[model samples]
Target chain A: MKVKTKHIMNLFYIPALLLFVAFVVYPFTQGIRISFTNWNGYSQAYKYIGLDNYIRFFKDKNVLGAFVNTIIYGFGSTIVQNILGLAYALFLNSKFTGRSVVRAVIYMPVMIASLIMGYIMYFLVQYDGGAINDLLILFGKAPVDLMSQGPRAVLIMTLINILQFVGISMVIYLAGLQNIPEMYYEAASIDGVNAWGQFKYITLPLLMPAISSAVVLNLIGGLKLFDIIMALTAGGPGYSTHSLSTMVTNMYFRGQHAGYSATIGIFTFIFIMIVSNIIVRYFDKKEVEM
Target chain B: MVQNNKRAAIWRTPLAIIIVLIHFAPIYILLGMAFKSPKDVTSRWILPGYIYKQNFDIAINKGNMLAGLYNTTIITVSCIVLIIVFGALAAYPLARNRSKFNGGIKAFVLGIMMVPPLSILVPLYTVMAGLKGTSTYWGIIVILTAFQLPMSIFLYTNFISAIPTALDEAASIDGCGPFRTFFLVILPQLKPITASVVILTGINCWNDYQFSLYMLQSPKIKTITLTISSFFSQNSNNVNAAAAAALMGILPVILLFLSLQKYFIKGMVDSAIK
Candidate 1:
């Protein structure tokens, strides 16, 4: 009986293993190989360029600028979004009336596509006729060019992203909140621990897992952000908001250096791997302690 | 003390109301712009006097919004179905069997999840083109399923492992074959996880722009994301029309999320943290 069961298991396993190898393993190896050659995306013949593309990437100022912008966007969105999300989670997790309705309202932005959000936000931030500028005029304040200038443009775009996805972080945090035993809060209350102390001791520490996950996901999402930036600014005004992916897309489309674009992609892969691995390791360690 | 408690409640209620309004400010802005006339949209904050049918008509006709909607629906539904069927089947064995290979399979799937989708875009695009899958409905659907398969399988495996093994044994003893046992017994037990998968994958597939942009180039095959980007390019000045188009695109998703907010939130929280 046991041998027959094992054979049945093998039948299932073989097909899955084959699919994984064909789809994932082969493509990954091919991607790395293609990175080292000066092959146009279509061409069959190309010369090997060992480390040449990498070296060119270092010298390229736009690539460096994209790297900086990615880091800024990543850190900016991750921190702001998670902090707001955690706060909202805590607020809704309290004993409140109509909590479900409040949650649905707040989470509305998360359902719509980021691309659509970007387009809508563009209308809301335009200089002449934007919803925001119109409101500013009503208050006797001068209209601000939210999407025209460099720093403000990046800032507004980051804010829009945060608004659109913070509900996701909140949901994760809410799950963490539910996992905490009610006894902890009761004990804190019996000890006359104020809300601040109870939250500091009970909520923050216990919520670490969700916090780490949210941070990692948001950081990666922010770094890999291309759709929104493409829709909103198209790396605009002068590539001020160019991300790694956008830069890769631009380079590949420009059609001179597919190899260099692959190099940039490889670098991005390595960077994301390092950052996410660190966060994962940190969470794994915390998981053991908690 | 009672009076003080009532006073506190009153203050907190207003504070909560204010926060909710602030949170929903963007949607309100969009709705306001969608309804306003072009001249009114550009002017001060005074309310528009009339409904703007022209913007909706223009957006629907000039932007080809309905065609975009049709394409998006087809891609989303097809991808969701493929992910549901294949992902569940692949996950069943991994969940039931405990072996070193199973461990490796889990790790491989998890590793693929970590790799940014952009890194593989060029190669995947080449492969799709080579397969003559580019610019076809099947092209985007296949890629979507392939990309989402790992994560959906992971979720299903996690949920399935928690089910008792006695059920499987009982089915086998009752003369049910493995295939029948799976479909009749195991598949029904997967409703919760399937709900999660459907909600998550459906939303992601609907919202995806990058894959659709590269894989589907024909104007006739454009998804909502590509269509919206094109609208921005072509109708930069028609703010009300663009807003109307944008509203049309997001309204269905917004309504779906609102109706299923509980399941949606639970699914997201569970899968994400796990």
Candidate 2:
């Protein structure tokens, strides 16, 4: 009975394992296989053109641009989100009236579908009859088309992502703050430690875990940004604003280069896996030292 | 010192209020656009003076907002149920048995959580196409469940690890098999953690766009995101009706979040800081 139950316990996980194999593992291997061929997604008969996709990817300026944009979206959102989120957490952690109300208001956007948020921002930023442009017109300034410029469009979308999801980082920091005992600060104050010193020493080291969590989550979310780009710019003015995620879809659907698309998909998978692993390990090291 | 502190509090209240207003601006614009007439020619900043809800009517009747909501509901509910069952059942042994193999299983689960589904978009879609899973509720549900299961397993494993092993031992000594012990003893104790799992998974499934977009291509069975997106693309001139469609898509979720504020916040902390 003992041996059999142990086997049963292990068997419980098989269904989950099967799902992963069928959905994730199988498709992933197929993605690799398809990357070697020139399958146009509709054709059953396609020839294997070894290393052509990789060679094209290396020489392709658009792919290079998408890579650069992905970096901006990923790291830019991480830095801005952590700063704003920590600020919000520090401010809201105080003894203020209607504090919960403020937190709720801030967090409300995180619940909104990001794609819908992107569409809503469209109304505000459209060149003509837009909410922001209407406000600008009151001061006799010309209406500016915000989404027309590729770089600015990327930044605006990143900002949009930051605003919507900042609540998450804020709450994680809040919970981290609450986990800390009040006596640490009280003791620091009695020992003549300044506010800055207390924050630098007591707060920073202790909040490392939360920082790690928030940063990693933001990085992953930003790296895979697709829906907002689609809703807002649709990789417009060229393929200028496409992240690797959107680039893959655009390639397959519009460009019809299924081989290159699969290669990019594989590249993204490997790239993110490497990046996240490094970040996790780096955080692990920092936590150990602290 | 006392006077300075008093002045600080006075300034603080207005600062808080300003922050609240700024953060709430997106919804404010959405509301303005949703309620106003298309020909009003007024700035989105201006609110409608009278009750004009024709935009919403247009969204409901023409945009198929009701059908979108129904399809989304079915997909979200089924995904949540499968995720919960599969996640909890898998976490049992991985948490209970601390062997090398189980440790490897636990690591694999965490690894899967990092996979952005967009990475597998092509082959997965083809696999679905082959299985005739495209445009069907069950196909999307199963796919969503598979993707979300890893996070659920991670959360469950952490929670279950904290429960006493002695309870399992005592149940075992009382002539209970593994299945019996788990269903009766372990499953009941998972209520709190399960709430966290449910809310977190529920939000992801409901707000899912990329998966729904790729899978449900047919107009008749559109998800909320798909329907709203198509509305924007198809009717660029009808901004008011599109905004109304956007508002309709989000209202239920916003209401749900406001009511369950504590659970939502708690779940984020749980998912992240663990």
Candidate 3:
């Protein structure tokens, strides 16, 4: 009877497993295969280029620039966004009126699509007739070229992302805050612990799970950042803000070495997998400790 | 002491409100731009006293915004339905049984979630093109479902595991088969999580631009995001018209989120914390 029941369970799982292998597994294998070929993204006639594409990618200045910019953007966005988000979360977690309204308002930017946010920011940051410039003129100060400059353009984009996505980290922190028992704070207070002391010992330690999640999410998002870059500057002013994802897409569409673009994509995928696994494992261990 | 506490509370409340206002200023700018005329948009800081219907009218008429709306609705709804159905069905055995196979399957799905969509974009595009699925609604729908499956399965598996197996046993003893047991016994218990899955997946499908841009080239099959992008590219000078189009594009998603805010918030928090 138990054997029959096991057979029935296997029957139920077979179809789903097949679909998984076909849709998820097959394409991943095919993607790896395509990375080795000189396929022009359309034709089947192409040679196996061996490690040449990977080698060429290393020598390419644009590819190197994209790599550097992507890392900088990812690191910058993750650190700034998390810090700001945590600060905001702590502020709201305090005893206050209109906390719910505050949360709703803070989360508003996150609700809008990134592309729309990018377009809106473009108008706001443009040199002439932009909202920022207009405000600057009103203040009797010279307007700075936000999108035309090199590193500053990327900085401005990162700042916009920080403002938009800080709400996600804040919400996660709020969840972490709720999970901590009030007794800890009360006990600390009895031992002559001030507010900062209680926060340092109780809040910081207990908030590790949320912090871990926020870090993982922000890192992944920042690394894969493309939509906003596409809309904001189109990786513009000579690819100053070009991310790996955007560069891969541009190269593929521009019809200049599809295999090389695939190689870049493969490298990015492996890099993300490594970083994410490290973060997830580290956090999982920490969660077990807590 | 009482006076000091009151003063602190007063200061904190106003400060929090100011922070919230600053955070939401971008959305207010979007709304403001949507209502301003093209000329008024040049001086964006100043409030426009009147609604500029011309931009909205032009965006709809010239941009074929209605067609884009139809395309977005069809794709989002279709993809959401597939994700819920297929994801729940796939998650059942993993949740019910405790074995290496089931554990392996669960791990595989989780691993797929980490692979960024950009990594698979080129190959997936090729596959769709070869199958002659590009430039069609079904193509985008299929790609959306495939990409969204891992996360949806993760969510469904987590939710389904919380359900007791005794329900399945009871149904089986009553002569119910596995399929019947899932639909009648287990699926009803999945409503709350299903609501969460629908809202999250629905919002994602509605807002996706990359897949649509790469897969669909025909204007007839364009989704709202694609249409909005094309509109902006074509009419770079018409800021009000662009803003109006953007507003129209996101209205459905915003309304959906607003109406289901409670469920959406709970679902998101629950999924993350889990």
Candidate 4:
């Protein structure tokens, strides 16, 4: 019976394993191999120059800019998302009339695709006839062209991303808040611990696990952000706003520099692996210390 | 104390209402503008004066929304089915066994969840092109299922562990085989996680843009996201029409989410903290 069970267990693993190997593992290994060659994405014949792509990455201005922008976007959005999400979560956790309605409205955007949100925001941020501009003009102010400048465009994209996703962290944090045993708060209050002290000492410490999850999830999502950037900026204003993910696609599909694009991808992979590990470790340590 | 509590409620209630309004401003503009006539679209009117139903017609007819909807439905449904079935099957063993092999597989799936999909896009594209899988529903469907599987497996494994091992023992004592035990006993209890998996994967597949953009570039086979994006770029200046098209594209998913709000939130929280 034991042998039969083990065999069936092995059998159950086969389908998912095959799909993962074929699509993910195989493509990743091939991506590594392709990055080393000047293959151009089409012709069979190509020459490999060891470390040439990696070496080129160090000197390429656009790549270096993209790397910086990626970090800024990653950390920038992650920080804002956590702060706002936690605030919203805390607010919603308290009793109020129409709380569910408010929660639904805020959380609705999280369901919509970021790509769609980007397009919608494009209308809002444009100089002419934008909803924002229209509201601005209603206030007797000049219409600002928010999308024309590179750095500004990047900021808008990041903000749009944060707006669309804040609800996710909010919902998660709300769940965490709900899960906390009410006894802790009651105990703290009985001891004359003020609201802020109770929050700092009991609430915050107890919520570390939720904080860790939210931080890591948002960081990874922000790091790998593509759709919103693609729809909103398309790495425009001379690639100034491009994150590494968008830059990789722009390099390959439009630029046709497949080999170099793969190099960008490989670099991004390594960067994420390193950054995510550090974040997970840092959060894990904090959780333990608490 | 009663006065203080009442005062706090007064401030907090209005504040909450304002926050919801601000957060929902974009969607409000999208819907409000979508129904406005062309001349009225750019105005500061918070609400449209009249219901302009023709915009939906333009979005549906001009944007090829029917085809987009068809393609998106097929892809989303297939991806959800595969994710649930395969993810659950794999998770059962990983959750049940205490061996190094299962341990390694669990770790591998978790690791893959962290891999940025963009890193592997080029090779994935090439492989799909070589296999003639590009532009086909199955082409994109297979890749999405693979990418989404990790989360499903992770969630399902965590959920499955909560099921007592004694259930498996009881099944074995009855004359049930391993597969039957899982199907007859274990699978039924997975309804909650199953709902979670379905809600999460459904939204993902419906909303996925990057993979569909790369894989399904053919004009005839665009998903709703790609279709709306393409439509907006082509008619960039037609704000009313673009807004209409955007609304049309997102309405189905919005409806789904609204209807399944509880399950969706449960799924998201379960997947993340696990």
**TM-score of every candidate:** 0.95, 0.98, 0.96, 0.98
**Residue lDDT tens for model 2, B105-177:** 9888888888878888889999999999999988899899999999899999999999999999999999898
In model 2, what are the clashing residue pairs, if there are any?
Answer: none
Top-lDDT structure, candidate number: 2
lDDT of 3 at A114: 80
Which scores greater on DockQ, model 2 or model 3? 2
Pitting candidate 3 against candidate 4, the one with the higher lDDT is 4
Position A36, candidate 4: lDDT: 96
The weakest ten consecutive residues by lDDT in model 4 chain A span A1-10
The native-contact fractions of the candidates, in order shown, are 0.51, 0.76, 0.42, 0.76
Question: How high is the lDDT of residue B255 in model 3?
Answer: 76
Off by over 4 Å in 1: A13-24, A43-45, B1-8, B41-47
lDDT of 1 by residue, B217-252 (tens): 999999988887898789888777888889999998
DockQ of each two-chain model: 0.57, 0.78, 0.58, 0.78
Cα TM-score of candidate 3: 0.96
Q: Report the lDDT tens digits of candidate 2 across residue range A5-47.
A: 8888998899999999999989989999999999998789998
Report the C-alpha lDDT of model 4 over B1-274, residue by residue, as the tens digit: 4687688788888898789889888888888888988766446347887898888888888899889989999999999999999999999898888689889999999999988999998999999999999999999999999999999999889998999999898999998887998899899999888998998878889999999999998998999999999988888777788889999888997898889889888888998886
The candidate, 1 or 2, that scores higher on lDDT is 2
Across residues A166-280, which tens digit of lDDT does each residue of candidate 3 receive? 8778888887888889899888988999879988889988888788878888898888888889888888788778888888898889856678778888888998898888888
Q: How closely does chain A match the true chain A in each prediction, as TM-score? A: 0.91, 0.98, 0.93, 0.97
